[model samples]
Target: MEEEDEQEEMYEVQEILVDPKQKAVRIDKFVTDKLPRVSRNRVQNGIRSGSILVDGQPVKPNHKLSPGELISIVIPRHGDRPDGIVPQDIPLDIRYEDEAILIVHKPPGMVVHPGVGNPDGTLVNALAHYLSDTDIPVLPGNDNDRVGLVHRIDKDTSGLLVIAKTESAMSFLARQFFDHSIDRTYQAIVWGAPEPPDGTIERNIGRHPRFRQKYTVFDEDEGKVAITHYRTLSDMYYVSLCELKLETGRTHQIRVHMGSLGHPVFSDEKYGGDRIVKGTVYSKFKTFVERCFALCPRQALHAKSIGFIHPVSREYVHFDSELPEDMQSCLDRWHHYVDHRRANNQLEP
Candidate 1:
């Protein structure tokens, strides 16, 4: 315990070593070169404080030390840790691949990019490995398009996502998604059924009035135009299964639209329900959901099917990811319960 604490409380002090020809250089630059891992902000902060001493006295952030001056740097222990975003060799479930496009299955809980509190094991990192190993182009416009990443899905959302390998393909696919020509259908377990079994939500979505963290539907100028179409698949006592086809893909569009209608998705901590289930497949499902939720994760809302006009050939291209295991188990268990209850009642009568 003492060793661990000492290791965490690490600090350093460096003697000012200056070259005869390096006397004209700036202090911040000198510090930056000396400490390549430290950020510019930290160097500036250190200089402004008395922690950085020049010739055994405090100096401003801008002071350039002369050669032969004894500059003392009292490196403070970690005030903040750097977030390391190194690319790791992670496996990606690729559904379809070609020179023009690639369809991948993004697993649940893998964040699309490095963000606050999460700095590793992202979809971006996975794509990095895919590029190095396969030598495929992911870039759409520039050299970074070597991965030709066309669009992105949420960290938790899984299914058929298309990537463009070339600039032409990228522009074409971007336009397709923007114009809502691509057929994108998702299977969602929402809290309740819509009053009308099949309908469209034309409400605009913007930041919520009360909770800025979430999106809401209301008449506002700052909001973006959004639309969604949903059809009831199955109706339960407290919840329902529905197929959502996107007319316009906006941030949290499906989840927010359903929430605006008072029907958020199941196990959706952001919009609403985290209903606990106790059973067999559902027990495994409960564990799956709990694990997914262990890190602000929600139940996977899968893109069951996607159809689009081929960017290069003009012919249609379609792909699908079967309901992921956990969700499939939920549906199977729901049906099993219905069948068992119906047969038991019939036998009793």
Candidate 2:
């Protein structure tokens, strides 16, 4: 959810007219180059779905733009179809709620909002259903897809999220997040112990040029600034549990930063933690790692805690969450493995 491109929380309608002297280009490429977060694939999908049109008519993705032609598009808040966010019966772990806001403990694997591959069963859909009688007018500037959401975590990262139920609440909470005053802490099982136990990582992060789905560190001139402060909670030899605090939120900031430090989050297939990055090559060790991966098929990361100012009450509020079963069970196995190896004097020097 910290990905730069994934920051938008409102459905948007954009209209652009080609200049009289503009050169002809494929609509997909033209739209992609013109928009900030829009991808070529998303543009093509929009064209196919008839959400994108030129000169008041639907066109192919490869349709060439002509001078004075008008281009119009509707970008979904996340990936939901502009018209597809319907109230559903999806369950939510509501932690706290009031007239001004709602605090939710989002579980792993549940998307915060609907998108292309995901049409429903999202937190937004559930909120729509839960607040059906509240008459909450869609958080001011945002469309119904966003509802009360001010920020979000990844679909695979379980954690706390604050939702603003009113215009004043949304403005207040959004400002806090933009100012980096909303404190958030995450626990991640990462490969190897970090050098010096704890420190801060300052780098720029941006989407990979070749792999659009992945993010990588970039130079100051290219990407946005990202900072993560981390401390090792437990060193299990082969892997360590780390607590990370973010100063600036960029897309995949923690994943990219930790991977750059040579200790990717454990079992994070996208960042190369799915393989054995450290520890012995013994068959037993390999088997143990494979089992651990089975215990937690996704990245071993959790949004452990969050603290922020309450918009209406003007008081500081903090929320904490326990690790989910998959992550906890995986850690338990690692703990047992480490203890047994140490007792048997089998650990490498």
Candidate 3:
């Protein structure tokens, strides 16, 4: 029942020692409580598959654990889970590649992996086609076709991604992400300039109670701790360009955190960035802002860079990407607008 990395091996083993003061408990329940994000059904399935063992002997789900005993569990990882997915020959913007790993520049409008609504035409499908002849390991606990992905970015956010070609590479890269050793930076254009210009936004993020698809910040201990360090790069009066560094990779952390500060990313429809949140209500200014929106219909955000230790080389690797055309065009317009207004003011004097 625990959610594990999809790129992990088929057989993962864990050993635990029971305490003398502990009472007898069902093996399934014991495991479910022990593993974070694991479910009861998964533990039962593992037991049924004879993957659960006590003292080197397979046990049933109803079996109870005793004190002062050794418990070992062999989780059967999901095998060839992407068999149902058909690979398509989609082109990729590869940045760096070697025997063990490859860094790809993912374009906007491409889904990272297959899911309920998106079953095909994903980045995974393209990777499958690109590596059709290679032997990529099937990761445990992953139900979908995310072959070698260690992490993911939003569909609308274009960025660089590192993919593992071997199991050792996968494990090493995943560990780096879990330890927060990977350095990731993003560039975004927001509605208005933040008051302090540069600061850290530390808040807890959880699923919205009413909207299942959206996320929100929590004041209590309900959500996971999320931290983002941001600094202003350009201040254009109405809107500002900022760089953000993440300490944790929670879902929608950057978007939700910035939205809570009343400076949502430009054109982010999910967090109400489509509407004008700053600037005058005059028809001329509104129209100008509309033109800026038209230049970049999606959120004005991009994964600019990422750095991590090379899994096989034991050396540090860093990759950076330029802003996409849409975002660059949007910023150019903002700069032009600011310069034009300054010229008008000088002429009036």
Please give each candidate's TM-score.
0.64, 0.77, 0.77
Please give the RMSD to the true structure for each candidate, in Å.
Answer: 16.6, 10.9, 7.8
The C-alpha local distance difference test score for the whole of candidate 2 amounts to 0.80
RMSD of 3: 7.8
lDDT of 1 by residue, 274-334 (tens): 6543223446545644553443246537778888888678789888878777666666655
**Any idea what lDDT model 1 has?**
0.63
Task: Estimate every model's Cα lDDT from 0 to 1.
Answer: 0.63, 0.80, 0.77
How many collisions per candidate?
12, 7, 4
Best by lDDT: 2
Against the true structure, candidate 3 reaches a TM-score of: 0.77
Error of 2 at 88 (Å): 0.5
The 10 consecutive residues of candidate 1 with the worst lDDT sum are 1-10
